[model samples]
Target: MQLIAHRGLVRSAPENTLAAFADALSCGFHGLETDVRLSADGEAVLFHDRTVATGVPVAAVTRAELSHLAGYIVPTLAEALDAFPEAFWNIEVKAPAAVAAVQTELKPRIERQRLLLTSLRHDIMLSMAEALEADTGFIVWHRPAALNSLLYAAMPHAHLRTLVWYYESIDLTLLQQANALGFRNYVFGAQTDHEHRLCEEFALHGLITDHPEFVGLTVTPPLQ
Candidate 1:
């Protein structure tokens, strides 16, 4: 199983910042998962919330304005790709407006195989899959919805390539079902040591966690 850094090793640095991403990679995380939103100018920026710390809507302000308000400039999607050219990316489009911009920025620079585009909005995920060859995954925050997604992905004709579930929503039954169906399962918010162990025991395809080191250390067992 791969250990993915959620928001780029957020436990080590500010979430979605370059510093966090660098820390994750340096510590040997297999991939990076981040949230993307469009600035006022339509640039794709790394951010998790619709608003900044001061409650300014990111879409309503230019990246520069948002940066000023936050005291540090947020990394752009392009910047992240440039800085970490070898890293696998799981880019989550946080809003419909960001879909096109994220695709445009990534299409030319990265290969489809190295990326996984996901979102809570099914329409946006489908649109991105149509626009790019990269794999598409769904982010399910609720248990019932997650079960539905799992069942759907089991269909031979289903286009879903991955299932990203909220960590708390997953259980042994769901894991077994996903494994039985051959769907690549990933979980987010894996913050505890026990959760990391569960990921290994289940052989999940990946885990999204703020503390990558905790999981990264166990990605490969010590050589005998």
Candidate 2:
């Protein structure tokens, strides 16, 4: 089971910031996962949520102005890449344009084995898969009802080899069914030791977690 650093081991530092991501890398995390959204100027920035929650709107600010916000500064995908050179990244593009922008900025730096682009939107994911020529793209499907439809649509294609469905709880039955239907990667449950065992049992390629160090410690028992 591969342990992914969710938002850069959010427990230790600010979520999705360069400081937090650097900590995850120093802590020996296998991979780093972060969300990407488009800025006001159409730059691919590393951030989650559809909009800024409490303070000034990110979309209203320039990249330089966004860097001066309270807790976390909106970092461009390129900034993130420059910050962490050796770490592998799993970037979740929030929408269509964000995906395109990320592809534009990060394409040259993305060596085959180091990056995995994922999204919740089916068409966006399919389009990204096609554009990036990736062998397998991770799609985040939340509701159970959407799974059948998504799989149905993706069946005709060869590039999409993985499906990452999020849920409040794990239904092994559903997981089995999904795999039976040809879904390659099934990411479920919380970040826990028990979940690690479950991931191992299912032969999953990766496991998402809020804390990357926990996964590194629990799954592989770090090298001395």
Per-model TM-score versus the true fold: 0.87, 0.81
In candidate 1, which residue pairs get closer than 3 Å at backbone N, Cα or C atoms, i.e. clash? none
- Candidate 2 deviant stretches above 4 angstroms: 135-138, 141-148, 167-169, 177-182, 186-193, 212-224
Worst 10 residues of 2 by lDDT: 213-222
100-128: candidate 1 lDDT, tens digit per residue: 89888978865533788889886787777
Pick by TM-score: which candidate is best?
Answer: 1
C-alpha lDDT values of all predictions: 0.79, 0.69
Name the lDDT of candidate 1: 0.79
* Candidate 2 structure lDDT: 0.69
